[model samples]
Target: MFSLLPLGYVGVMTADAGWDTIEKLVFRPRVGELLFNTVALVVVTVPICVVLGIGGAWLVERTRLRAHKVWAVLLAAPLAIPAFVNSYAWVSAIPSLGGLFGGVLISVLSYFPLVYIPVAAVLSRMDPALEQSGSALGLGPWRVFFRVVLPQLRLAAAGGALLVSLHLLAEYGAFAMIAFDTFTTAIYDQFRSTFNGAAANMLASVLVLLCLLLLLGESKARGNARYARVGAGAQANPSRLALGGFQAPAQLGLAALSVLALGVPLFHVGRWLVAGGAEIWTRDALATSLLQTLGYGLAGALVTTILAFPLAFLVIRHPGPVSKLLEGANYISSSMPGIVVALALVTITIHYVPGVYQTAVVLVAAYALLFMPRALVNLRAGLAQAPRELDEAAQALGKPPLVAFFKVTLRLTAPAAAGGAALVFLGIVNELTATLLLAPNGTRTLATEFWTLSSEIDYTGAAPYALLMILLSAPMTYLLFAQSKKVAGQ
Candidate 1:
């Protein structure tokens, strides 16, 4: 029920607005323009991200790329810098960077790693037998990769593409900074211009539908395919293909990616920090924002992890229609833009539960809903590691059912739970749209504070917050990459 609040909010808002009002708001030139911008952004960006992700992953994991280990980490390092920070850097460098092209450029640089990390994880664990058989059949390396290898990557690619699409939909700061208008940006504009206005709700309604379509598209793209070996002696390391003449090109591509994605943000942030000098660091608000950001990130992570455990356990321990239904609810809920989730909570609390409106509880709950999937995915994996047989054995050894579950199953999931919590922490710390909408008066997170200063064109003033946010996110980003490798049985 809680998970469905976002859908319900849109439904209720649309109903309240009536068909005429909704039509006026949604079926207009402005809405059409925003839709085109949003769709074009996804269509142009996701494929490039997929290509880059797969190629980069293949090079790092399956080919003789120089400093493969270093490249692996470097490719994923861009994720430590928030998308908006990347936008800030680009806009600072080239103020003319805007519109669809700029949106695509910044988004690809910032988000390709989303695709890379997962596809790389999948590639690292791929069975070389498929490729070997293809080679035996006289297929060249490129042919084997295209025909045999790439098909297997469909699931990962589809998932990564879905993530990229959703990020584009949810993103506001990046596009906003680049002067590109998407559904999220337009929705934010609507809300700011007219708080709880009919048009804003209607725009959110359309955005929600768009999200549902992407979900369905991803479902179709991802088909029901399982890749598990029936019996295995041991997993063998996939043989690395020598790059020969392709070496320099691959290295150059990766180097360029590193420079654009990781380099720009670091350089610009450092420059601003230097310009800001002692004035930025000495600001009391900087320390306050850091502490508040940590406080909120920690709180949100704890809440989300706790909330995710039951759903993950239910799906893992006892898979059934009910569990699947609940799981689907969560995935759909989490896939919605943070703006929609924040709007839903804002509407619900302001109209129904006035006491908690704009409180930390509301903000935390929003974080949990928006990031629960991170926790669920990890907890499900961890739960699978423990197995039902262990719980039965623990109970057989004279322990109560509940005690057995706690001592055995729950204990084993601790590390995964912590990892998921860390991801949730990362998400909340960098989140912008939702924080702007839902945070109470006087609340100041690093993301919110950075946004505040950056909005005023004070990139120098925003420098410390950007630097601190990157610093805070770096470890979590590395953890995310390392965890993916570990999960692939590296």
Candidate 2:
């Protein structure tokens, strides 16, 4: 059903008015400009995100920096601030920061943590023996990293880059805030200003193509590389590099990154709060939006988590062509822009279930479809760790298969399941496009509300919602950091 969304998109493309729409939109210089802007942003931002993520991870995990733990948390904390919120902060602080440069800067700052967490986890769990071998062969630290450590980091880094690319492709709010014309923002504009969804759908088709190319590129980059160690001996802590004279510079760099990524948004939010100019912070609006955001977030998280379990179990336990295909389908569907999913649901619901059209049920379903992969990935990781042998062992102890699964596998995977649910919840809270389309009358999420007010140049009115969004996402940010540490055994 989730996969059907893309098929619906195909139907949209081939409908009666489709070819002419595609030809006109495709040949337009505006379409070419949007493509260039989108590709250029990804081309620049992905590399920057990779470097920052890997660099921050290495500094925190492999350096003798003071208060490494604090630094680690600080680096990961930016995940709480949405890219749109970051854009709002920068553009608000400096009104001229409203173009391609600002878009790239805000996106990189907002998303580098996606790279940092996975890379840091891999770094923490890596066998130090490899590094030791490199050192014994007379390789300097830089040479050892380039030859040994970096090869091991290839899979994680590539995976992070793919994620960054998908996000850049689907991102509408941030780029829209900065007046940068990307496919996503253009799609939203096409839908909003002219109600010309055919053109928007064509733009989305281009985005879908970009997403497919990225997935293929990442898979090729990953190749058949195996990162696990061969030795059976217990692993020991890796040695930290002495920063020496570079320590001050490293500290300053980290400080600047944190300020840019995290501090700026918070500072602007605080400023707005103190100025007391927000017209939308009334009791009814605030209470209603908060409840709606929480309600949708919780419902979406729960549904996505439930749906992900069986799929994760199938992929991890029964690794085969079918399982791999199913997993790939999930990835493709999840990578789709929210507008695509929203249009798909809108088409289906309005046609088949007219009573539920534009209802909260449809909106929550969109959230589940868009975010199920977040839950699936974490659940797969947890299931992989919980081994089938544990379930068999429980069965050997006279428990039934179902009972054993619940008693052993589910219990062991609980933390991962919770983490996945938390991630989905945060995603739902921050989701803008789908909510804008599917939310019934009188429903208002913080994301949609913020976008509405900010679009009207009412930054002060948007501040409370933005701050609430950050506060709501903060615990999940901490949860992600703690979970990564647990995975790395740090």
Candidate 3:
């Protein structure tokens, strides 16, 4: 983690002489605009995600949509395509799709499923007793939906929206290609071009502030629990609103949106694959990159998930200001972009522990730093669902705390833990910016390989790996959706 400290030390000592140049980066108009761009992207994207989430959940769970299971799988499959790769696909397909709208489109396509999966799970598990009670009282279907069902959706929506917002704020590679100016892009620009350490730090500090404000907003929206064991055994016949007049338009619109967002990019990849199969299918180098990427991603996910358990257990079992702070600190690293975290770690390592600089271990640690929050968030939610009474009952027996935890609590939380691990693994596999900065010399993950090829105007060469990554990420997404269903069930 301290892999970049010595570089920071050098930057600090040098800044003593060029303080004026560094001062130029301290929250200027450019920074403000970048900040606004980032916030606007989140603002635009989160609503889209939420709407898609709620609507998709309704369509699949309640409405008479055919092959709803297939739709569920399709919606979640987009998550398999990394944001940057999605950017590459879209930009290559339609050069005009660049800037704010492009960012929103890619993010919505990539992240709405985060919202959709959870809300759909919640919808699937929702008990219709209160809703029926509302109807029994003299309320219309819309009234029941707006007043009752919508209220129940707030927690799941908040959680999903929070994830979207954080991802937007911290996004890097996708933004780099899309001509969207955000703090993350600026920070990376500073690091790559001038190596302007102070400028990057200043931007990072602002990004962190933005994240805090977002956290506060999410906290407010994430209300206290209402009912715990809902839809466990109750008949969940959700009231499906009829779309008699609106059916064709609704289906057409959804189909068009999905095609435009997902289809065009895939079409471009197909073009490349058909045109340059022989050129891109060279065995040795591609295999090496794929293996390295898989190893690093799998290793990083395992380590991060293991590390997150203690923090999550503490926070859920012993909720307090201190515990919350520890959990928040864990997310802070994640809420910031990979480049920023990589820069900070680079500075720390370069100055304090030079030996670890640019090593694979340092790179894996960076992945853990950037992705542990994901593990913690899911695990904490899972832990909260574990009945406290079970622990008490276990203690009543002769089982030790550790033994009881492993035997009971951990067993109960395994699905959630596995779910979180799946998310982390997916993230590490798709991650780009930090991997580029921290990976050992000559070491190329699929992300780095794709970026390197794309940088050289070799998009054709990049397609195979991009396709492979999407394929690898597909099953992980399915597992996540399944786990979400499991969690919502509980």
Candidate 4:
């Protein structure tokens, strides 16, 4: 059913002006420009994010850096501020920061944490023996990392880079604020200016194609190499590299990153809050938006997580071409921008389920489609850890398949499921584009509310919502850190 949304986009493309329209649009200079902008952002941003993420992770996890725990939390805390908000802070601070450079800067600050967390986790859990062996063989630290440690980080880094690419493709608000024209912003402009979804759908199709390419590349990059050891042994902590003279530089660099990513946004938000006065605190709309945001986030998380379970199970427990194809399809949709998903849903709902068009149900459905991959990734990881032997043992004890799953498999995987749900909830709370389009009449979330006031240049009015958004995301950000640490420790 979720896959049908992208199919609906394809149908819209052909139904109106047939292939000629698509060909003209696809061949247009504007399309080329959009593609370049989109591809350029991904190319530039992903590598920078990778360097920052991996570098930061190495410093925190592998070096004898002081206050490593504090640095880890600080690195991951940027997830509390959405990229769009970060863009607002930077552009507002320096009016000239409104182009590709600024867009790339803000996005890197916002998204490097995505790379940092997973790479850090993998680094922490890595076998000390590998590094020790490399050192014993007379390899230096750099060579050992490049040859041995970096190879093991390939899967995690690739996965994180894939996520960054998908996000750059799907991002609208941040790019829009910085006046960077990606396909996502182009589609949004078409929808808003002329209400011409055919053009938007055409652009969306190209965007989907880009996402498919990314998926394929990441799949090939991940390959089938297993990083886990075959035999069980007492796990030893990896030796920390002596930083010596680099410790100050490393700490200074991390502090600068945290300031850029987290401090600036909070600083700007605080400025607005103070300027906005007590009147900002007394607005009835503030409370309403908070409740609505929480409600939608919870609903979206539950629905997306529930929907992800079966797909994760299918691909993990019954791996094959068919299951892999199904999993890949979900990822393609997950890579789509919220506006694209919302437009596709609008097309389908209006044609076949007009009654639910513009309803909260359809809005939540869009959230589910956009965020299901997060849940699927975590669920699949959890299920992979849970050996089949446990399930079979339960079956041998006379428990039916369903009983065994709930009593054993599900119990074992609950932590992962919960973490995935938390991630989905955080995503839904921060989502802006789809909520703007598909939300029922009079509905508002923190994202939409913040965008509304910010668009109007009413920074004071928007301050409360922005602050609320960061506050709401704080707990989830901490949970994510804890979850990453738990996975690494295991």
In candidate 1 the C-alpha lDDT for residue 270 amounts to 95
Tens digit of per-residue lDDT, candidate 4, span 57-97: 99989999999989988999998998888888887788778
The RMSD (Cα, Å) of candidate 1 is 1.3
lDDT of each: 0.92, 0.87, 0.80, 0.87
lDDT of 2: 0.87
Q: Rank the candidates by TM-score, best first.
A: 1, 2, 4, 3
Candidate No. with top lDDT: 1
- Residue range with the least summed lDDT across 10 consecutive positions in model 2: 7-16
Going through the candidates in order, what is the number of backbone clashes in each?
A: 0, 0, 17, 0
**Residue 347, model 2, lDDT:** 65
Q: What lDDT is reached at residue 281 by model 4? A: 87
Model 3, 224-321: lDDT tens digits are 66655533556657766677877787677668767865686688888888878686798577899889988998898889889899888889888899
Q: Give each model a TM-score.
A: 0.98, 0.94, 0.88, 0.94
Per-model C-alpha RMSD: 1.3, 2.1, 3.8, 2.2
Off by over 4 Å in 1: none
Top TM-score prediction, candidate number: 1
Candidate 1 vs candidate 3: the TM-score winner is 1
- How far residue 304's Cα lies from its native spot in candidate 1, in Å, is 0.9
lDDT of 4 at 69: 89
Cα lDDT, model 1, residue 111: 94
